[model samples]
Target: MVEISIVISLILIFDSYLLGKCISKYFNWNADYFPIITIGFFVILGIFEFFVFAFVKFQFSVYYILFVQYILLIIPIFVAIKVKVNLIPTQKELKMILGGALFTIIFAFLMGNQTLGEAAFDSNFYLSMVIENSTSPTLGTINGYTGNIENISTLHGYQGFYYFHSLLLKNIRNILSLNNTSLTPVYLWTSALTYFYMLSDILFHSINLFLEKKSLHTKIVALFFVLVFFTNYFNISFPFYGNTWKTLNIACNMLILYEFIKLNNKKSLFLLTFLNSSLIGFSSSGFFIACFIEISFFFYLIWKKEQNYTIYLEYWISCLSLLIFALLYFSGNYTKISILILAIYCLAGYTVYLTKRFDAIFWKKLLQFFKFIFLISVLLLVIVSYFVRNSMFSGSDSQFNGYSFFFRLNSLGDMTLNYFIPVNKIEFVRNCVFWFIIFINCFQGKYEKEYKFFLLLIIILFVNPFVTPFVVKYMTSIVYSRCFEIFINPFCLLIFYTGLIEWLEKNKNIEILFLLALEIGSIGIIVHNNISYYSKFFIPQKGYNPVYRVTNDQWELYQNLIEELQSSKLERPLILNQDIAVKAYVSNIRVLIDANTSRSAPAYSDENIDAPSDWLNIFYVRDYYGQHIWKQDPDYSKICDAIIDSNCDYVIMDKEVVVLKGDLYLPLWFDARGCSEVIYDNDRYVLLRVRK
Candidate 1:
């Protein structure tokens, strides 16, 4: 246990430091977020540790340890270094030091010695995450997950990700010869921590940057953006475990931006080039696409301002190198490196224009500039082509209407959270629910020119999905490919808030009042929305939910329900009433068919045959993957069929949703056919058995 503890600490340190070093080295920025990040990491670990030590042997195995501790310390750094990433231990050290006091204070408040580590679900999830960790210790792989990712395991759509991660986890499980899968509470908390801290990193930098340019009053506004964007109402609403990494991608992208803004050296340029490239590549194309927007804006700024490409030519080369590396490393088997090569060919061809056009001294500089810009443009075109191919191929079906609808209604509530000023002694959260709507407007409107640019770029980030939610909803419901879009809306908000705060620094009264309103609104919305949504469904999720009050009581409550399900003698299979619910999925349990995937098929699939698609919903609804399934009606035939066909046992699902009343009678259909029976019931959910 001690050895394991040490290993955990090392991993945490390595993870934090590697990111810190890379940020400082390549971006030449003062990004020392270790205190908060470390606290977040450890607080989460400590939460789980309480339960682990409480029940387990707590034995010490440091002596017999494989001595991988050293590797743990250096691997992340080495990887960054091998890539010749320029990191700044000195600047990072200072940030870590200076930021330490504040981090300690905030962390203590966030954690408060309440080790929330106790197991909240079946041990299968626990064992799976551990066994899975042994084989695939690859960088960026979230250590472990709880659910089985077989054909039938989805709650909504075909989870291309679930399958992908499962393959890696299964291999590790096999090395240890484990036959079952499980997720630990620690896995949940750690994963959550990873995402939260990723956002915190962005908030930290953006806030600090805002602080640099603004007054004390304006500082608060900047902080407001920092908090709101990180605690995006949408994310707080629909935070599934799978989507946790999506949050990470956004924070990482922001950090990349913050770094990009502070680049001071070739090394920093090089690292920013790679880190941002890889982050967006692996995390999602949306973030990288956002990065592209940033790149384009920067290029326009550089070229338009100086009217010369030679000045930033090296940086462009670095970008090219990073792009090449990203394609080589981050691309899947289907990746096309040749796309970039083609751009290179065009660039070389374009150089003919430069060579023929050059005469003497006057023309030489012009010719050189043309050649450099032409080459860079060619390289860039190749990169763009690769993305275009990926985009054209990647067909998704998520609707923005669902997300947009949720955001508008909840904006007030989110503002409440933002204005929730922790007075340290207040036993209860201050209910500033009143200011939500008014303050939420703080996030809206044209704030700053730079902010406006960010907002416009953010909208442009939705370029891949030209069709809005109306089209998407009517076209494709419950498709898995639409998951990436989940982050775009909130992330754009984050960038906007960042830009807004930066613009608001000129006014003190505006900053403070703006912050108060913003915080109160965001927090209130989350807490209220969370509670209201869960009254019936009882899962940790949000979306398409309509009701009264504000805040996320449902989410907080599910933490306990998750506790009950995990430790209950019955070991109920976790069921989700709605797909947008974050906790149900993040809990890493196999779920009943849900919002994650849909039951419908779209014509686009037939029309865009080559549109690389993820039929996630089909797998679950049709039992193609043999995942967990449950019905509300105690039907014999359907249950029997499900058990025989999909190996389902007990199914725990909500049966009281008014909108779903028609479908909820599926169990009744089974009973009419004489297939299944009810085993348990509550006001919210009805449990049934098919295997027996």
Candidate 2:
């Protein structure tokens, strides 16, 4: 398993660099930009793969996707080689890259066992995805998760793009002849390593942004800050640690923001558009980020008089095409919608491109008119949203009820901001001092305009003052809150650091040693607070580590169950009560009632659960079917009836469960004796074959 993980990591590094080089060649960017660009290109490729395989039916072999991906890579490799792009790094750059790589390794070793805290279930879902996609790649449909449940509609829309990454990981595992159970650990390790790499990469670039002198001493000091800042892991945003995709979105957006700030010509605009669209494809929250980026860039260009309007129009059209195509494809359609959208966008883009040499005044007037129309449209939308805010409450989680739009927005903002910002009186004083320095430097700072514009953008978007009613009416608050973490909060931190670093560099008295000491001292305080904070929140589970996702006992039981099922020669066995862990670890198993949504098991879906009330209770409650109620012993007779009704071939249960019958509790195996034949039994788990 360790060898396979190392192999996968090497492959990831190589493929990302190659892809980044291939894509970056168009923009003429050097190898310094590869790490962040690599992540964006990889995600873009995965999303493109989804479009390419739109026609493929569910249950198709993962080998098909693998074959297509390699073929895709080969084309780019050929072009890149023919173009003779430089792949070498200078000594300084090499050191920075190695430092980042080393940080990834050490961070993974220290943090791999840690769960996602409240969101730990998401990791299980990801594991289930890797396991399921390792066999059959489903295009966002629930059919892959549900066994014997067929013709179910799609539940997850654009999220299908997210699964392709998991499929790619598992495909590599299969190529290396690794056991399926190795996927959980490999995934956890790779995610942790990759998450750390992103932070290190972000830190490397961000420090370079502020540092005019790239001396070895300055570099070492910056590296020291990275170590200190990240070691206190809880000081960072939770999504950065807990969710890989969300982290990718944050990185991509940050890169896009930086690119927009450097917006100069056609190439940069094209790169920004590519990154922006790719981010939108990966995360729905990215839509708002894209709007902010593109709009901000549009105005920035106008303000700077760069006259790249034609390219901006083309970029806008491309984004529109992508959004429309994704909407159509994930709407459960396998038709010509993609083709139609592409053609429409192509024609629109061509028309815009032809006007590049048109009179400047005419183009300016046209842009102004478009701006007027857009502003009016936004105004009307905001007004209309106020009347429709009540609609969001219907069929939604009751927890969101009774809170005003601004209250909900502020609450969500506080949740994400709390990770980095302190609320203590000491922190307030420290912030006041820091802000005082930043305020004095603002008048003559090298990046004053850029940093202030970013701050203003954050205020407008973060507070979302004008759009609160509209946001509440249309979008989920939790989902919208991610915008704060992914863009707003990060930008706030970036502005703070960029200003402070610039201020420090201007002051000769503040040597590298002083800066390093300040960073260490500040981070030490934060680390102390984190130890206290996390000790209360992160309770260790039995048989589980802070670094690993699965418990040793659960892994052993799943591995044993897989071996037994294989030895028994059950082909694509439909399983009941297997849960996400079993569905993920045991290859070739189809679940009948996942008891969870089809985020992991795309085969079995709950989207079609519309039975009458009594039947709903039978399957959802009384029978303990179609639900995962932890520690609640199921009624054996009802479970048997459910297995029969659902036509499940096998049923799995914890051997420790004691079924409740009237006034007495009895061992599950004893009560379930006549229901099924025991095929596999162990201290932790029991697998039974339903007697049809």
Candidate 3:
């Protein structure tokens, strides 16, 4: 796993450099967003750097320390590109990131992964902190700490993308906990650190917006406003606080992209490429789709304004680097999505070449080849889309509450934004406004051709909804793939917008007003969400509400159960489907399976309540019919017995599985004679042993 991880890390470094160059070439830095971004990255570097040195000194693991150090070395230097001056101090921006980390710490101590302190959509994230450094990284809620079997891989959109983040977090967390046995501090630190990364993203870029060196106090205050206002807005105004991973990552990528464009240095490009890849890896399957969009748009810009097609080498390097990570990702769909990504970028470049010049018969035939492939792709897409629409809905993989075609068709406006300013919507409006303003102003000049494309792109996008609805249903069906669809084109539009905004137009202020109105509209939609969502925090609601979470009582119960099992003297008989498996790390007992592995089991799946009876026949539990399956240490007669095979210690029957729904792990006697012994029993769970 470490070998694979190291390879992945290397690829991420490579992609980060290349993708940053491709994107930076097409995007212009906007002052409004860059200042805070600048401070955010610098602070991230300093703090993470401090932690690395401190950790290495404590552990003496030079190599591990260096990997963490790379984060600081790579990320902050990119941020520094936005810092033009040599005299100004960045102490204030660093403090804000620290202060934000402090605030995050306060919440970390009070919160665990359980529902008690758990926020909506924000799972405890402590597991991520714990196992980022662990050797065997698994997915789902149940870890060695909680013996419950959990299939975490399924919960987070795609397993491939999810595992990448999991491994990194576990590896990091373990590095922190190498000597100290206590986990709470580890928990507190990881949580706080991630928040620091968040602040780094915003503050570092925002600080870059200042043309001249501003007061340390001024930069500090501005960074604070960006973080607090945005944090509050997201928690209150958008549902994204729970679901979206791209919010911070995209900002960081854009900052790197902008920095590269401003500096145009190989070092800058390398920084952009690496971080952009990580941000994409942060939500791989989702962001893979986004990168595809960006790569395509990038070439369109290049083809429109480049020296030659030889520049295509850069795109290949970045995409190839991205493909390495994508291959490591666990889903088939994500791998397949790369095809569309390639096609999009390739097609865009060809379109630009054809539109820009008339190169007679030679060019026309080449164009025909591109056109043929494009038509075939569209045909294939339409056919697949027709079927996809028939099965549209989120949670399809979850067995939770997956929707079919009918439900999606019923939900039009509610699907994308809920009239609320979701991060996805924020992107949509920002890009749309950019298109409207930039195109209208550039009636002539360099942007004229691109301007026309923007108008056509808008018409196609709006028309896409109408056309897709009849076939593909939901606009957001791709799942977690919300940002890339719009961000790439907007980058192109804004590149034009920025150039046009600074241009000496006849009615520049009027265009600015038009753009401002769009920005305000997007903000307004998001703010209204805050007003309505105000009821969720401070005063909690029931479990059914989207905002409603597990009650405090339930959390206390879950924790106490964990503690009780720790104290019990059952000889730590390999527990299956419970927390005891990983928590076994501290407790002197060994558990078999975990909720991390079991929750995703087919038996409890909403879609497939697979037969647990099969397990009785397929393993050591064989010859153990309905009654015998619940017997003490399940009887394995012949190793080659027709029915039983897999080796497992014990099964944890809990509220997690409806098949284990009855208060007990099934009655002892099939023929009425009591056959099994009860080891542990509770309102929420019960443990049984197979008898000899």
Residue-pair clashes per prediction, in order, are 89, 18, 76
* Local distance difference test, each candidate: 0.37, 0.52, 0.37
Alpha-carbon runs more than 4 Å astray in model 1:
1-10, 18-28, 31-73, 76-181, 212-221, 232-267, 286-291, 294-298, 305-692
Best by TM-score: 2
Cα deviation of 29 in candidate 1 (Å)?
Answer: 3.8
Error at 16, model 3, angstroms: 14
TM-score of each: 0.49, 0.76, 0.49
Higher lDDT: candidate 2 or 3?
2
79-119: candidate 2 lDDT, tens digit per residue = 66887866675564576678778977766655644544432
- Counting only residues 3 or more apart in sequence or on different chains, how many pairs clash (N, Cα, C under 3 Å) in candidate 3? 76
> What is candidate 3's lDDT per residue for 66-95, written digit by digit as tens?
465456446534544553323222565445
Can you write out model 1's per-residue Cα lDDT over 356-432, one digit (the tens) per residue?
44455755565467557745654554455344322331245122233332222222222122223322221023223
How displaced is residue 109 in candidate 3, in Å? Answer: 9.7
Ranking by lDDT: 2, 3, 1
| Candidate 2 local Cα displacement, residue 634, angstroms | 6.5
